[model samples]
Target chain A: MLFVPGNNPGMLLNADVYGADALILDLEDAVAPAEKDAARVLVRNALSACGYQGCEIIVRINPLGSGYTGEDISAIVPLRPDMLMPTKVSDAGAIREVSRMMAEAERESGLAEGTVGLLPLIETAAGVERAYEIAAADPRVKAIFLGAEDLSSDLQAIRSKPGGEIAYARGRMVMAARAAGVDVYDTPFTDVNDEEGLRQDAELARALGFTGKAVISPRHVEAVNQAFTPGEGEIRYAREVMDAIEEGKRLGRGAVSLRGKMIDKPIVDRALRVLETARALGLGGAEHE
Target chain B: MSKLVEGIAEAVRRSGLKDGMTVSFHHHLRNGDYVLNMVLEEAARQGIRGLTVQASSLFDAHLPLIDHMKSGVVTGLETDYMSGGIGREISRGVLGQPVIFRSHGGRPEAIESGRVHIDVAFIAAPAADPLGNANGVAGPAACGSLGYAMSDAKCADTVVLVTDHIEEYPLIPASIGEEDVDIVARVDSIGDPGGIVSGTTRITRDPVGLAIARYAAQVIEASGLCREGFSFQTGAGGASLAVTQYLKPIMKRLGVTGSFGLGGITGYMVDMLEEGYFRSLLDVQCFDLRAVQSIRDNPRHFEVSATRYAGPHAKSAAVDSLDVVVLGATEIDTDFNVNVHTDSNGYIIGGSGGHSDTAAGAKLAMIVAPLYRARLPIVVDRVLTRSTPGKTVDVLVTQRGIAVNPLRGDLEEKLRAFGLPVVDIHELKERAERVTGKPETVRPGGRVVARVEYRDGSIIDEIRSTEE
Candidate 1:
């Protein structure tokens, strides 16, 4: 839900729309190679001047060793982005290097150290294999994103319906991030014109335990958000299940029955997770309000 | 005897045009028109203060009118539509008198009924003869139909045909006959016909415009209006032209040939006619040169007057026979009341030329606009100026969704059956607000600036001057 084409001031000014969780003032992949410097300068000035209307601001500096990464970091670190997403990370060493550079730039610019967080992009086959190490590389690393298009190309596999080609990489990334105690986001569905395709892709990501899917278009934001968040009926049922268990516990009963089924600990835990996920998206907490 | 005159100044003098008289002009030349500016300048040179200029429509090209307005040469204004510089000054209350707004149909009805008296009507003819026989289809400034000026010619005390090209004493197939004219003034150029139609009149490539057009076509198909001998009209705009594009495929699929295409005809409508999607084009105004060529060369393209197009007083008009018409709006309220007269901040930018008239006449009056324009939700709590009443407007189609008026429950269900995003008008308003946020209500200061008149000649809404 973070998107930017760094060279476009107009696109950069296209803030406060689509209700993105975070906006990545993208300098990599989205920008032309010749305009990298222009993109960096534009992103730096935009960060200094623009507002994203309460969305967390981030930047995807060009990949380390792409040669644009240092200039991108040097130009942007002083602007103090909320987070930085590095494109095409193949290993932990790259993440550590970016974190070090961010630290040095932060100190030089007189900003509080470690103010910016980092999210390494897991694109290539090596990147997926080293997801755990990359996630655990630096304290600033809070989440990692999969680059499905690149991963499928690297695997020499044809991407199919419901994302069969990237399933293994998705599972590995999720498990690696979980083990390393960092959040994981799925890759964006490239076919923006196909809303159904986007919805199915987002549903698959949600079922596989990703928090949210990366979106390439503003139109995709709503579908991705809906797929990630629990529906109203699900939220209500989760609340009802929790209330029954709470009442049973308060009455000193060992069992709780709902709709003629005896609910046990695992079921209760699942309901709790559902409610927690909804509440995390700022949905079910309003019941108390 | 030949009715030729010396210049605009001589025509004004020979017509005995006085200081306080109401001089009229037609906007058939559209943005390319030079007659309005030239005549006003001559009238100003004549020291004719307190003169009222009754034009069919005003464009940015008439910005020079602002100078005359300031110099006290022109003290009053009346028109079916106004835009650009003149509209800005009028909205700012530069003129002491309140402007009078009439629908395209209403203006002719007024002129015919003696409600609006024209002292001297200036006709910008592309081609004219010494005897004052003129037509829009003949010269370099050819604009196809002089439908708007026909009423002024028939009713004005004195009519002058101003042209750059004067032919032999006889001008064949005259749109305005010589008997109605008192004088003919030849000029260097009537206007640049190329500027008459811009690239905007073509189908839009914007995804939003395409989506709305698709939904609009679906609405037409769902309403069962895309059948054999269906009569239709659409504005010359991105979404409107795109609707024509989408409808062509639908019409082809259904094998239904529409009866006629009406309103300001564009090249797309001409294409529809030639492709057998439609039978004929009843062009009251032509939006492009292709339409001009079609009107002149093709027997199927017939030029009709504004009264014959949508006049409520007419026993039978073309709009009355219309099965559907696609329009655009600046604002639409939950009640389905429309405002095309002002912007988000309530500054005047447009006036209803045929909006109310067609809405009143057509069986299915569909309004297509983006849900929000530049973050200003077009669906408002209430329109700033109620240009077209809610009851007359049948359906509202936005890029995001479609809403039918409560009066049309059948259309609501029909749209839903088409698998279109059919929502309540209020829900559509809320959806737009969810994206654009609710804009602050724009209630301009208390001074009334213009009166929005319905086709039946009743004041529907009063546009107040914006002091802020």
Candidate 2:
């Protein structure tokens, strides 16, 4: 995903050409306080006027108490964006309020109820603790995102490049979202110039079981996508494992062995998931072969 | 037999520059050149009138020529390229005769064929001996590869060498020797070193530019010509130069060794030559300080004259051997005709320095540009000026998609087989129109302001004066 400034028409017009799976039209932090109302209208009209190629458009509305969320939600909900990411979200009540507002707007606009999904941003320390409740607050909550910059300031910790300060929060948020059966996203690596550092950070997030990572720069999109995709060797081995399973089933055998190693249920499931993700990304798959 | 004159005034007097004669100058010094202004000032002081200025290229530093045109000192203009400073005045019908615009190759061809007679040629040498032997690789205003001036030295009736640095008896390895020079004049300074060569030529950081470059590189790779002994040329524009940068890794991965890198050389091309990605560099001009240094120190970085570079009348030129060339455009019509001479507003901003020559010579000629700039589509229904005809152009690569010329069906099939986004040229124009609504065509009115001459000595297009 890429975060495009909501107020910049140039960036907004070109947001989808960068090959990002999702575009976050940011109106919370990128737009100034003085231009909040104007940026909301600009983003709403942009959604109506322009085609984001095929990217899933997510509008990042202001927090619940910012005095602008009500208008942002009302103006953009009628556009039927793919999702709405509410910033600085703390507890289940915040999620419920935004969900209720979305439902009301959907009904008034003649869209089916829960037409737009909700992505709760867990930034504060209290939000990290109650992440599960927020993720499970309503059926509209599709995913929970980690905003480490605000969470570090809330904890009064020094931010480092290796991101030791956010380790606990990352683990806790991932576990919470997993327990609630919702997808989780990691924070954006802020350094636009450091591709090596971004690679390492994205690898760490993937290892920690985050479904995807957001990027603040378009240059980082390719590197992040590369780090998250399964490699050629992995894809080849997954195809072999599936072939072995098929052969075993034809022979009526109880177990399948590939290269002197037994392919168990968990291994089969992991292989299937890898092939599924690779197929979704339009890579070389068994179907193509 | 010293051949050394006191100053430009003496040189102008000794050359017998008549009132209606044509004098020429090279653009090695680019925007920092003072020799053009100084010589024209002396000619004006000498009460010369109706003189035609034949320069290889003009820059913003040559804005004084506009004043000379107004004062009747200069009545005619001929150049391969003109920057916006002087071009704006020309577009407003300042000169009595229309400016004759030619490709870098066509300029030398016209000079050699005697179709465009030169009465005098002023060569700006950074370092020269009293015997009129000079080189561009020394002194304070050291601009490497004095390639454009070599033609003027050989064919002009009178050749005057102007230099700020006077060397000892014999300047070894002189780019322009004493045999061709008539008078050697000493000046305080030829040009500012800062503007002669750029300090650094950095790759583009714009994502849109990079995306276009990436697609162009892919097109080159898919052309099936990127094998052993690949020869390439690209301009100094950010996106054009970035294509060279992107091709570096592809060449490495494929173990492809290019025969030569051509055109106005940049530091990135120097690096590629030094790294063995290319066996050598054929430079007609140095665009940066690194290129100047490399041309001075490395034997592999050889300099060639403008005629040898791309002159259509020459027996053969380096452009004939080129596999690919990447160019930029202000506007490209659906037919692939490119207009680099005028902007969308019908204002003269650039010209075809090597655009037409290389497009005619290269096997695959690709144009890299964004689909739209500032809400104006780059692919228009028709261009304001046709600097390069559509038949020679092969591909148009934009961030949205790549459009191959319908004439090259084989290339279109190759790009499609590689899974590259190959769209019809008309569809590409439509894609741009969908984003930016159809723009009103700009039809410049009034008398003709410039005549765009192709490399083959035919008038391809005529640019009319812009109405205020």
Off by over 4 Å in 2: A236-263, A285-289
Query: Which candidate leads the pack in TM-score?
Result: 2
Tens digits of lDDT, candidate 1, A185-279: 99988886898998988998988888777887766776798898888888887888888887898999998899999998888877888878877
Best by lDDT: 2
Candidate with top DockQ is 2
Cα deviation at B116, candidate 2, in Å, is 1.1
Any runs in candidate 1 off by more than 4 Å, and if so which? Answer: A1-28, A31-289
Candidate 2, CAPRI quality class derived from DockQ: medium
lDDT (Cα, tens digit) per residue for candidate 2, span B421-444: 999888988888877888888788
> RMSD of model 1, in Å?
11.6
- Candidate 2: true contacts recovered, fraction: 0.38
